[model samples]
Target: MARIAFIMLCHKDAPGVIAQARRLTASGDFVSIHFDGNSDPADFAEIWSALSDNPSVTFANRRYRCGWGEWSLVAATLEAVRAAVAAFPNASHFYMLSGDCLPVKTAEYAHDFLDSNDCDYIEHNDFFASDWIKTGLKEERLIYRYWFNERTQPKLYYASLAIQQKLMLTREVPSDLQVMIGSQWWCLRRQTIEKVLAFCDSRRDVMRFFATTWIPDETFFQTIVPHVVPRNELRNRTLTYLIFTDYGMPVTFYNDQYDLLLRQDYIFARKISAEALELRERLGALWADEGSIFRPRTRGRGFSAS
Candidate 1:
């Protein structure tokens, strides 16, 4: 009886999120949602009312105005996870995902697979050793301080970087941290999450350092994970399927990409187009189909149906 708690960070598309929450809870999984503070009040109210009847659904109390590459994103995720943890004590795994993400596999399949495995499925690699980040300030993101939101204050953001570069003003990675980077989405064991949160609460210096770093959402938990979870217990992979362009933007699935979506064996996919109504409906039906088990075509990874 392994249960999962899904923590979703959503900013838009209330209908999509509401549909997803109902579908997720249909199989007895717990869903905790955190709507962005900047989202439309009407949409937020709509989602809240839509899922109010579901006992397995919970909403985070502390919402933050989230922005790209800002610490607010991580703050919002923390709020969601805290709500999920409080509501679902029996949840063995905790999955952090976006509002646009939807599962391609049944809840039974996800539980069956995770119950049999001991390692966490999170994508992570040493920041300096990997070339996954193609553009922007890669390694410099760790050592530099970013006080302004890149999306909202582009001039201040770049100007700050320029001043820091010119003055050689650099910061240090917390001595206890290794500075790992990875995809923001991950599926972590409950124990791992507990340890991560505990460490965060106890270490004020580490939190303060990451708060000013570039895109702390991508590196904060990633770097803390290695120090908490042992090497053998970490899978170094993600269950969510996502493809990034050469420019580092995630590829969005649309109505015409049905075949492309089905060909992948991942349980969930990221960045679905908001307008893909038919695609979502079709995928929703497929996900709720429990007659068949999900089998991964590629054995290269450790994922399996059994």
Candidate 2:
């Protein structure tokens, strides 16, 4: 059975995605991809050639260019998910990710546990704004899509800090509306994925409504899952885990964290720059751990490496 499917989005992070997917496949998991509207076909071909295993790649339709809070980016992902469902009907869980996301551990450990839980990990209620991701107090802030300018705040380093500094200066978003912050990525159940897509397809009007909104991914998935599963059942956080500063600043875990990451506990991590040196070291670490930790765990049969 196709146990899990990773819905990965990449603009140019092909090399990183390739290394990550290979490890996942080695553990007997199937992988699927949707290169974003921006990746050139030739670049994609180079990516395809690098992968050791054969994985399905979907072409994402980019109806419009998206900025930090723009709904279009989320719209593109939804389209890809819709396509994945039509194509891989039998998969048990639908996992979402970015090309920049690298596994902290192996897929088997994460999938084995998730498959057993038979629960979804989406949050429904409005995320009360308290520097949501440290963006602001509540009043002046916009969904990251609005406030984050890739051109102006090109890297996450600048983007996250720039936004936070502004918040410290203002300390508020607005009193009018509620704002919630969450990872754009998630691990949704097949039923839930179908339900969310069905809601969007059934109510094209609602889809249109979200598209115009800022940072639609945060709202789109958060809104749809609540309709299918009770808000409480939706997990409030990603299960794979993370490392954050004492002040709750997220520090990118890299090859140095590779040993900990490949430990039998985690699924994935983010803000990984494929351009970084750690990719190779992390891949090497996974290769070393793969034999003992990843293999027997394939069918829920071995000791967890973490």
Query: lDDT per model, in order?
Result: 0.83, 0.58
**Residue range 45-123, candidate 1, lDDT tens digits:** 9999998778899999898999899999988988899888888898888998798897767777777788888888877
Positional deviation of residue 201's Cα in model 2 after best superposition, in angstroms: 1.1
The worst-scoring run of ten residues by lDDT in candidate 2 lies at 295-304
Error of 2 at 157 (Å): 22
Model 1, which residues run further than 4 Å from truth?
A: 298-306
- Candidate 2 lDDT over 1-306, as tens digits, reads 337777767677566667766665566555666665555777677666775246544344332344555565786677667766765666788888776666655444565568667678754446653334444323333432233444545586356746756776433332432445566777888888888777767777565555545456766676567666766567766643445554555556454655544442446666554555766555535532633554223211122223
lDDT of 2: 0.58
Residue clash pairs of candidate 1:
none
Give the TM-score comparing model 1 with the true structure, all chains together.
0.94
Residue 289, candidate 1: C-alpha displacement in angstroms: 1.5
